[model samples]
Target: MNTLLEQLKNKRLVWQANQQNAIANTDSTGYQELDVALHGGFPQQGVIDIDSAVGIGEIRLLLPALRARQQQTQRQLVFIAAPMQINGEMFAQAGLSLEHILIIQPETPEHALWSAEQCLKSGCCHSVLLWHQQLEVAQAKRLQLAAEQGDALHLLFRHKRQLSMSLPVNLAMKLSPHAQGLSVQITKRKGGWPDNPFQVDMTKAWPTLTRVRHADNVIQLPQSKVS
Candidate 1:
């Protein structure tokens, strides 16, 4: 009994310590449908990866969180796009404030990577988004540690194949745009079913969610809202 009590107390202390130094602070993914897809919302100080090919639903997936960061009461929102091009009009379309976002177009991928690392280290922005097709384990580990040090969320966008392999990620997943629908599959998670997969239709996202037969599906919309 004493051992069990001591173990529990130690666990609490560890949790408290994690909270104290935790960088895992976030509001919500801007998109309601996507937030439900992510099991709640993205972690504040944890590292999250979004893998998608060009001209897919990746932009849609990030809109929610970007919007949320722009709405944060704490700090400004920053996005560093080295490989991809982010336009002011596109940001406005996603409900992200142009003035609140500091867009850094690095001359090279290396420079952009450095910018991202520095941004994470500074712990200034409410959130940081990095566009890189390849992320080495070392780089990810560094960002992960940085996120843990301060309360910040790092969103790394890579390719679809990136999640197919083992990597340094708290949650590894792939998102693709279907026929007016969005499909998501979990590659890895800290403590979740690796085989669990889910999808949400774009049309069913905003006002209502229309349930469909996607083998075993996990619907997260309101009962009345679900069709």
Candidate 2:
């Protein structure tokens, strides 16, 4: 019995080692600081959860890497049940080809999850991004399995409130707006430490200028030019 127990322990160790090795193989996220924090970037193929406040530019944070992946693979980038309409011109200005993007609007969250899982399992897209307001652990698990089966990058955008809920994803990050740009905190990662929050200047990666009104009845320049 003792010998059998030792054998089982050894097998577990081997499995863990293999998992770590697999996670080590990742693609760059296009931001040097983020890449370092993630120990490379998003896992080559798996579910990544991004939790952020509304209108915080969560999509913008990932635009650089997503654009790079699309260009490299020349495959479709699918969006499932996005809460808001994606502006093709904005993405185009940020270096992503609108032709490569496919947006799907599902009436319900269940349908959105189903569509996203199908897209991942079909291996038809290079990457799948889904915007979901709420997600159960079971649904997240299914998505993770589908991602593994298809070997496609799956990214889920959810509200920051869902950060407390546990999900079986390869990586989970929280994005908050910062003075410089976006503040990213890795809440969970497989085979990687949850280090301190790091700042990624996504503003430079995808520049957008907007006017602002000052208190003294003066029009302020764009935030990018303020400092």
Best prediction by TM-score: 2
Model number with the top lDDT: 2
Cα lDDT tens digits for candidate 1, 125-151: 767878887677777888887766656
lDDT for model 2 comes to 0.79
> Which portions of model 2 miss their true places by more than 4 Å?
1-22, 162-164, 206-227
The digit string of per-residue lDDT tens for model 2 on 1-227 reads 87977895774321243455426668888889988788788787889988887677778777878888888886789988777778898889878888888999988888999999999988778899998978887888789889888878999988855446867778889888876568899987786556678888755554552222236866778766555
Our model 1 lands, by Cα RMSD against the true structure, at 9.7
Clashes of each: 8, 0
